[model samples]
Target: MEAREKRLIFPFSAIVGQEKAKLALLCVAVNPLIGGVLLKGDKGTGKSTLVRALANVLPEIEVVADCSFNCNPMNPLEMCDSCYERYERGESLPIAKRRMRVVDLPLSVTIDRLVGTIDVERFLREGKKALQPGILAEANRGVLYIDEVNLLDDYIADSLLDAAAMGWNTIEREGISFRHPARFILVGSMNPEEGDLRPQILDRFGLCVEVSAPMNPEERIEIVKRVEEFHEDPISFYKKFESEEKKLTEKIVKAKELLPKVEISDDLLKLLAETVINLGIKTNRAEITTIKTAKAIGALNGRRRVSLEDLEKAMELALPHRLRDKPFQKPPQMKPPKPKDDKEHNHDHKHDHKHEHKKEEKSGSARNQGIGSLEQNFRSIEAKIPRIESKNFDGSEFTGYRSSRDVSITVVNFPKGIPVSYVPSKGEIRDVDFYNSAICAVLNDKKPPIKLEMKDIRVRVRKAKAPTLWVLLLDSSGSMAVKRRISIAKGIAEKLVESGYIKKSKMALIVAKGNQAEIFVSPTKNYWEVLEKIESVPTGGRTPLSSALYNLLLLANRERMKDKSVKVRAFLITDGKASVPLFGKRIKDEIIELAKALRKKGIELNIYDTNGKGINPGISYVPILKDIANAKVCKI
Candidate 1:
């Protein structure tokens, strides 16, 4: 590979076609504090290329001298212990400003390289010493890029989440207690096909842009032509765009300065919030980020203040992943077409099975003539019907009111010797279930048993609120690297985030791959990240479906409040593809046992077979999961 410096592009301004993607990235670069953006779409969609091209648009940064990690020199808030100690002792500190470095992390990296680990050389050569810096240390004040980020190993994902959240990396590995500033813009790209990024990590981004290959032939041809030209001579092709790139660099500087003046009104803020919530998209962060992003967008457009149009533009992008109404809006309850008045109801009631009570109409119409016979039969049956005594005919026996469409059935009396009595059982009880469990005591001793009335007995269906938890177990297996996998996974993930499947229910994700299962993101509105992670998973390894699920059981416990929040659910989104590329045994029994344990925990397990047509041997393992508790299978 070429060195990082030489591979860098001309500038952001000269980029063609993908203007929206470029502008959004510029906003994030100008204000790292705005969080980050999620770029979604398909493979060869330029998700990776757009992000890589970002280095061209952004200006270089300054850092502390002699720091390999490129630690910021101006921000005292982020200095290391050694640097801090030196500063306090009145030492003259050196500084240097250079092009900002882009640190790309691979999925297979060990925890040692991500966080920090004891230096084996130090231990061996110096008989034990201080810990050494890791990749996080190098990533400070830079771009930490992770491609196929959705398939990241569990331990690695967790460490990155912790670091990104706190802006500081605290290592607890191998009995070490070291701390360092770890503020960096986390840029991750994934194709949703293979799997999704965890919800927790998705919320960290302030902006998210979805990109795809230009559908138009003209744009595609241009894309191809540009690539071919670059391939022929990168330097010459980049030079052709260099002047335009510099002009765009100046635009970023102005956007940054003008950002403070860019205003978003309360109305737009509310719209942003409402739109996202209306989408049933989870995450307070989306609302918060929209406010910030709207301002950045306003500044980029050279507007001093936000307008309805500005709000519209911002909300269009900000609310796409957040709208609840888009997917799960309940069909409005329709009022039954007006029933004919009681004049008709009375006519219908006039007819009795054995008798008739008829009303003669002077008009002599045939339809009205039928009403006359119906009335005669009604009177006859009413007169013959016997009334049961000592019954509380009051509707109080019912549990709750019914919808207008529901027909009500009431029992007038109980058979002789049979009583609707409450029976106490020897176990813990729920008040509602207890009510539903009641049965009338019946007598089998007499033939043609006589009937009696129960003073009070009521059971009704009441609307009760019980929140559900949904887990999305995304397959990070290599097969998911296919286009179908990407499209379906993206669509499914987006829909669920918008709560199309289970409304008002929280969702979680578990990414499973070679002996690795990680919460790439958490259950929240940062779903755009989930989609990107889904598309970006590279097809290079075998799937460790079993181990990933087992690890998920542990996370579910934490998420469901088996240790914390009592609400818990699990969604296993996979083509059900398994692999032996890793050490874990590729056995049907192991995966079955894992699913069984998941079922035992009361975790609502759903296996969505994302594989389009046939089943792979890895997918065959899902059948064995039936041995586990409360598991369901669906082809999503």
Candidate 2:
């Protein structure tokens, strides 16, 4: 048993660095109610190693002996059908204790595999309905570790997140219905350079940790030695940390018992909210996670009350991912007015009010300053990661881009939207679908008892409408490079990529510079693909507005040819600096003619003015393009 365990798992205390990440994992172990954690780092940062090692340090849990869902014996109210039925029978259910395991979810996991599916073979053979439990069932009361989580399919990712958040996997397929407990600590590790997580999925994680290679030479040497030792003699390395792992397990056991008694005072709650608000976080999940994590830390230290230090640690783990910090924005200040009471007794009241107001004003101002300082620190850490600023596109573009169409198709079917139809062969079967299929079977049955057969089986046919195509006509000319205009354009393009992910839309990037117009990326629905192309875009070319407009016309024509019903919108990002022309004609005349022709193609153009004062000596030509294209105008 000892040798088997050592072979199966890595020792937690054996990990050399990533103290913060280790602490964050321990905090969640103490209190799974703190939600789950996301680890963002580069490759070879020990993110996955730490998570795998965590299972060894976590104490065993008591679950129903025969339950595949790992149903908690103590929580009868939340048990699965089998366990609940056993409980209802007034039978003493056998309990088994096992070590908490780390269940790995690979990048290629499918939705049906993450969530359970119907047992079609058994149902067809003996008319016995059963659920084939999946990863969620196996992960209950343990850790669900998703490696390379950013690369996971978007639909599968969405489904896993939904189950993780709800703590239950509901399955209704082919007349087999089941709802099993899916409560588990979700640990997702990803290299941010590969891709970015959607905001919705990112927010679902309770804590976000950033890990990197140890900078200190001593620490780096220690990591290398430990890794080498582990690889050379796994059993010896495991034994070396066995005592430490046992102590950690004991600590976690105690922390779990103490977590409920751990109190978060109003002061801590106020601090959590103030910290999140000051950091420009709009969601309340971060605030709740912060307080819960602080309490968990307090519990780990055998304390009854959370401390300011705990709050600080919690902020460090929870704020970085949620912060929408604008480095240029000034820290907010509290403004207080002098009290104006006239009565003799009111003078004392006024003085007290003034004192309280002054105190609050100072505290609020200090918190804001602290928030700014914290953001600066975060910026220093993320300096290597280029951040995309939020879209500042003018009102009309915002409205036009946000207006999503409602049309259904049989293409992409994410785990969202309403279920509309039931086909003979696809999608998960809901309870209603089962009854519908059962009714259809009964109505056609010649025998009495109304037995259903495999031919009677029906599944849901879900449909999702394809989103609009946003064509970005970016000006990568020399004029855009002046005064960081190119940087701003890149930032805007990145924002569009994010928007495309949220809106479920496709984005096409067209860059015109250096005497030519080229397609950086054609219409693509994948955010990672768009981001990769956006990063490779070259800057430093003469503005060629006429050539760019012609390309847009060609693109619009091609998209229409592919699908006439597909909606296409174009955003022209430029400084109105058109110098080159098509066929050696006058530049202005060529642009005007092309712009008129582009408008005729039914492609909506939103022109963003990328000009700063004195950056371009040419007179503003945006008016001409706007007139010819009848486009919406916006100033960057």
TM-score of each: 0.52, 0.69
Best by lDDT: 2
- Candidate 2 displacement at residue 55 in angstroms: 1.4
lDDT of 1: 0.57
For 486-530, candidate 1 gives per-residue lDDT tens digits of 445544454445441223344556667655776776654344445
Task: Identify the runs in model 2 with alpha carbons over 4 angstroms from their true place.
Answer: 1-8, 264-284, 325-400, 406-471, 476-498, 504-510, 517-541, 545-570, 574-636
**Model 2 accuracy (lDDT, Cα):** 0.72
In terms of lDDT, the poorest run of 10 residues in model 1 is: 330-339
Model 1 error, position 285 (Å) = 1.9
